[model samples]
Target: MAHDVQLEAITYETKEEVPQELKEKKLSWQKLRRYDSLDLESRSIPGHHHGHHSKALTRSLIFRLAFQSIGVVYGDVGTSPLYVFASTFPNGIGNNDDILGVLSLIFYTITLITVIKYVLIVLKANDNGEGGTFALYSLLCRYAKVGFIPNQQAEDRDVSNYELELPSGRAWMASWLKSALEKSMFAKQILLFATMLGTSMLIGDGVLTPCISVLSAVGGIQVATTKVTQDMVVWISVVILILLFLIQRFGTDKVGYSFAPIICVWFALIGGIGLYNFIQYDPAVAKALNPKYIIDYFKRNKKGAWVSLGGVVLAITGTEALFADLGHFTVPSVQISMCFVTYPALILAYAGQASFLRMNNDLVKETFYKSIPKPIYWPTFVIAVLASIIASQAIISGTFSIIQQSLSLGCFPRVKVIHTSTKYEGQVYVPEANYLLMVACVAVTLGFRTTTNIGNAYGIAVVFVMTLTSCFLVLIMIMIWKTHIILVLVYILIIGSVELLYLSSVLYKFDQGGYLPVAFATVLMIVMYTWNSVFRRKYHYELEHKISPEKLKEVVGGISLHRIPGLAMFYSELVQGIPPIFKHYVANVPALHSVLVFVSIKSLPISKVPVSERFLFRHVEPKDLNVFRCVVRYGYTDVQNEQEPFEKLLIENLKVFIRDGFGLPQSVLSNGENGEEIMDVRQVEEDMQPAEIEREIEAVDKAWHAGIVHLIGETEVVAGKGSSIGKKILIDYAYTFLRRNLRESDDVLTIPHKRMLKVGMTYEL
Candidate 1:
């Protein structure tokens, strides 16, 4: 029978260089949809994508999807204008050399950097629209040569041996490498970059968003009343920021449903205003499409051109996150939404503000109200500020995701990553990542005291990621694209030039506290790269020293300890070496009457604990002590060593432990609280007589069923024994009864078993 392909991860790398034995197998990467699920096609769920909906409904659906993407992807850039001008002119948006320099950077920043580089070049390199550093690296690793794999393993000393049996072994090798590399290397790098940059700007945004956004909003309140103080504005903004932090616990799952609709309204307001301005003014802002104009802005503003780099790079503040979070909504949706609604509204707001500044001059009074019609302005300001706040949520969420990816790739320490969406494999929430980021963000907020000062720290992380991406992509293009050297150089020149410009701009912001984020970024990069190098060396040295397979088999054949009384379980990693870890554990704590389980756990990008993959009893006696076996699961991050989970699973498998004289039970174990114990005998003592009258000599349990008991303990884990308590309920009470009946040739109890008898029931037949 065919299994669900949706649940399977197919490898994409070709097997060309591998031996003929491994050649028949194909490897394809994950092809999960934006919202992949087998059940979404059902007719019952309300507000589903389709189910006899009208064209108006369809438009609304598209609107909701598109608008959400805008809030998620482009919010940071759209909100930049709020603080960019203020930072350039501390007193006000006055026309100083710095002010014009910042404007030139901001204007051309949107053109040469954001439009020409990101949309026209980088986004096109997406792996089927799934972005992120890991996915890209994985695609690269698929084409990586195999000599890399063997050097890491000691068992492959004779390379010719792999030529004899390579296919099944290749599968096993891929599994181990993916696990180690992703866990130790990939995640840390991703997280370090996110934390250093995201945390810094977030702090800046936190301090700045409340004061700037609310002050701008409350300043609008002055049009209604003549009395308003800066003190009052600060108080109100502080209250709003507190409220924002307070809501982080509820998670965005429910909030996401409500958010999509409101975002549509917010964008509609901006779009309506933008279209109106485009019609009335025939705005020449459209001239931003020409990269030459951006070049001219830099040339004309030569003296402070370096300072302008940070401001220009602001247009691409959230680009790294978009690539980092491409695992969420589809790239088409994010890009389309940005182009149609988010970008248009942001441009209109900028143009409208420019016009207001032109007409009134007092519109630059640190109050956002003087720029538009009073009634129209108040409502629009409310929506715009609210949209900005929501946009911060994506940044926060993306920060967590990036950190998680970094940790997985071995760039950082092991931190928890939680998946928020049950259906979406990519929707994650890391509490450790979240709190650390919050700390960083708040610190920056306090340090900067205003968004204007904090805005400088914003573009560093994305620039680093983008610069690294360009380097990596250049190598890949040279390897894969077959492009001419001149063309490649031209591409690198365009990318490098813009990157250098941004790097210089941000350098100006350093004294203003931009170094804080850069410093953090540097620390994370060091830790990730350093730890990975150490781990690889250790693992390589350990595995390489292992004995050959012939020696291992000889050792296994010579063991006389099998007759020892106890269940001996081996801790099996099933890697290149034999099960020596199990032997070490057994030698350390040789428990008597025990069942040993060699355990193997498989974890996917998705988080659900797979139950069916659990394997069961194989009796492997070191010399023949009747050792029962199993492979139990305690989840991917469970800290219990091999002995603990296996012991617990063995205790639960007690019926099988006695039934097949201790056989395996896969299905019966997961039936209920414990599982439906096999309805059979439980209490047959072992017959020691080697000469029975033509009878099977194995001792069997007359299997009895045990009922499940539930309890929650109130205790906290002190560091890493994982949980202090693992509850085990009664799984089977009758496993020993049937065997006794069969031995005595007595009739089975028909009445007591009919109603599902509980404990303490005494009925004499």
Candidate 2:
């Protein structure tokens, strides 16, 4: 007999006709009946609204986006002029030779790291249109089965952003490399560890960028007047930092509108001043552009020049922002803004500062303010402060984005993610992360009280992240790009050697504040590792013990089960079959809802999943069973809707699937009455008018009006009976404690309390 025939043979019993033993076990029906009289006419879920908007990319739109990219993407590197010279040369400039050498190093570092490595190379490694460490890792996973999640489906590969095309003739090597990585569990674990370490370091950047940028900018107040002490600078910076974080909930779309113009003026002012100083003070300072001066500087002051590379690294402090912010702005937009506006302006600004220092070596510490032609000192100071705030805003927003990606990929604990803009999906705000970052920023400002110390810490975080990026980029070049071996080696050696040199210089100052990022990364690494390990273990445990659909049907048919009037949606992590939690619930309750839906929400390796392609549905057995499964997918950059919108969209899709049988054959729609064929699904769908579809929806609405309950499994993980003590402490104690303290599943699901049914279960892993 066919599967459909088997399903049709089973008869569903109404609630009143249920056996007395089953009625006694069906305790939840009484609570569900309380909603029987409630209104179901309103299709909207409370507190849920669909406000997402998409814009077209017209010429005017692209230009506008490119212009906005200036303020958000280039602010940190643009403001490097304020303190780079001061940080590099703490004492007065010894001679013209030292000035040329430091300037040469700064120029080359910016050109090599910022221009060639990032703008030209790293930007191409973006995952689909998205960039960042997580984005790169996501792209790598597409080429190899290195993702932590094991339940990935074939349909997941059909997502828009998961598309990857190798060169016409290099398919064999790509296939071999992918196979090798997938076959080894150890390799996958190592890849995840490296990616998580890079992500943690970027989070550390969020804390340090604001502290250094604001402190360095506000330090101008002390230069303008001897009465303004370092203590005053610290207080002012703290106030500014507080204000910057306080308005984060408003989001980047509003905050970023004014950033472009303010930064435009700042760049023009710096560039023009640089040109003026280079001409009037010392035109010969242009000699710093020669690479020979870099060699001569290192030769002249071997150890001193090496130590000063830490400060030179500051020139590219926010280089990662260029790539990370790709989801917000396009590659062409960022590239244009950097090459045309930001790059030239920064180079000129640095050249001007060097020229000023060459002529007036006594004012080395105040090179930026002193170099200003005096007429625009106060105005320039105000612009500098605004520019620094803009830089801080950019990184804070980037930090929020990274955390959201981490949560979706199961590498971070769940936190409330609020989409702050309707126009841009990537514009988001996390209240908890925002406040925590603000507190860290204030502490750093007060503790360091000087750009010198903060810059040391900032340099270490920046270089370490860059090095990790280079490491990931090497694999991307070979496995994805399929580039020639010689070319890959050249790319890695050049990028890796420079980053390591800077890394060594920063490490040499370990006692002088360089340990801050190390400490920050260490703590974050622990959190990420613990959360991900526990999550993976639980998933594997569930996968090993999942009940097949055939077994589930057998269990249901073995008993005379009662079908209640409403829908019951069960959320599970597994993509196929029934989770153990469902079996556990049915055994205890002995009754099921009229409609059963197993919803599996999975995150795909893409930036955004289109609304039309979000839900995939299939029948678990047949229509008579009222058991269906839905696999709803989301991209890392996608925002999850609240309950009302989610429920509305789900029911709408379910109706379409029912009407069309999701393209099933006409024979499959025949009723089991003497094996007679009923109306064909295609014929019914073609004959149905809008009114009939609306009426079908109305019927579903009436059933939902009775009440809808969300069944979630609350599982406790512990070591198996035969496990070692080390495993017991890690799983039973540490993992359990963290799970208790972190955000609960209810908070993430946003399920209404009155309509929720949690089934508790324990897993010995």
Instruction: Give a tens-digit lDDT track for model 2, residues 272-360.
Output: 99999989889898888788998988888899889999988998889999999988787778888889998899999999988888878
The alpha-carbon deviation from the true structure for residue 407 of candidate 1, after best TM-score superposition, in angstroms, is 2.6
TM-score of each: 0.61, 0.87
Which candidate has the top score in lDDT? 2
Instruction: Report, for all candidates in order, the number of backbone clashes.
Output: 67, 1
Error of 1 at 33 (Å): 27
RMSD after CA superposition, every candidate: 16.2, 10.2
- lDDT against true structure, model 1: 0.43
- TM-score leader: 2
- lDDT for 572 (candidate 1): 26
Superposed Cα deviation of residue 57, candidate 1 (Å): 18
Residue pairs in collision within model 2: 45-644
Q: What is the lDDT of residue 592 in candidate 2?
A: 85
